[model samples]
Target: MDAPERHPRIVVGVDGSDASIAALHAAGSLAGPLGATVEAWACWDVPPGYGLYLVVGIEGFEYAARQSLEQALADAFGPELPAFVHPRVVRGKASEQLIEGSRNASLLIVGRRGHGSLVLGSVSSACVSHAHCPVLVVHAPEEAAHRKKGSHARKSDDGQ
Candidate 1:
């Protein structure tokens, strides 16, 4: 008899940045091996301090943000990925949306910003701090290697 099905859901954040794309790739690799469902999420919102807020209104801003989110997901996932990969778009603070979604996810994944710092973007930092599940901060392999080399060089120079 076949074994019972067991698969965890992995959540990932996408924002069209190289970092986000890297995160998606990492999540896909893990999902494929683990038989897990990959949920690609993108969150959108207008900054509250913009003067255009009065003209755009909350509902209007939400509508635009949602549309952008949908387009972003479509562009990122396209039509080639497996059916088990699901795409989601939400309107709200990225951190809040990600943390809430993490409630049911087995793992969360995000990319390190292009600046190559552990200081995550606002959204990623929040997820790292508060997500209920394990979170993987994806970085380009070259970046990881570079950081390691830099650290080693510094240690050698210090003679300690």
Candidate 2:
């Protein structure tokens, strides 16, 4: 016998950043029209110097991730989170977890950039390159870009 049908799922990375918030909104918009369920994920992992941090009582990684997830959802959906949207906190690398999630998702959505301290490509870039499903990279809002430029201009003017 054939397997029963399932609703399409859209996986989006939620990192509590404005760009990520935009991604969540975009995912929600798409989900409604596509009849897909949006799965918003906030992923976290131990830093490289985990041994030292562990001694310093940095064991609240999961809690912190969950907090970010909640905040992002609130920012994206206001008081009422859409019924089609589900929030999740994952304990792993963002790119790896999102890529794994893509295996079962109809679409993978992410921000164009994130607040990670990566020396190379950002998580969205990695997801675009590696996700099993089609990936959508939502850019930071125009006002944010303008604010960033204005701040840079002020700093440069002061330096000059």
Which candidate should be chosen as best, given lDDT against the real structure?
Answer: 2
Candidate 2 — which residues are off by over 4 angstroms?
Answer: 1-3, 55-58, 114-121, 143-160
Clash tally, candidates in order: 0, 0
How does model 2 fare in lDDT? 0.87
TM-scores of all models? 0.74, 0.81
Error of 2 at 134 (Å): 0.3
Report the Cα lDDT for residue 22, model 2: 95
Residues 1-160 of candidate 1: C-alpha lDDT, one tens digit per residue: 9998657999988776667777877877788788899988877777778777767576776566556545545555665756877877677788899999999999999877735454677777888999999999877567778889999999999996
Per-residue lDDT over 62-147 for candidate 2, one digit per residue giving the tens place of the 0 to 100 score:
88989999999999999899999999988889999999999999999988664456422479889988999999888779746876
lDDT values, one for every candidate: 0.78, 0.87
Lowest lDDT 10-residue stretch of candidate 1: 65-74
lDDT of 2 at 87: 93
- Model 2 residue 39 CA deviation in Å: 0.6
Error of 1 at 95 (Å): 0.6
Show the colliding residue pairs in model 2. Answer: none
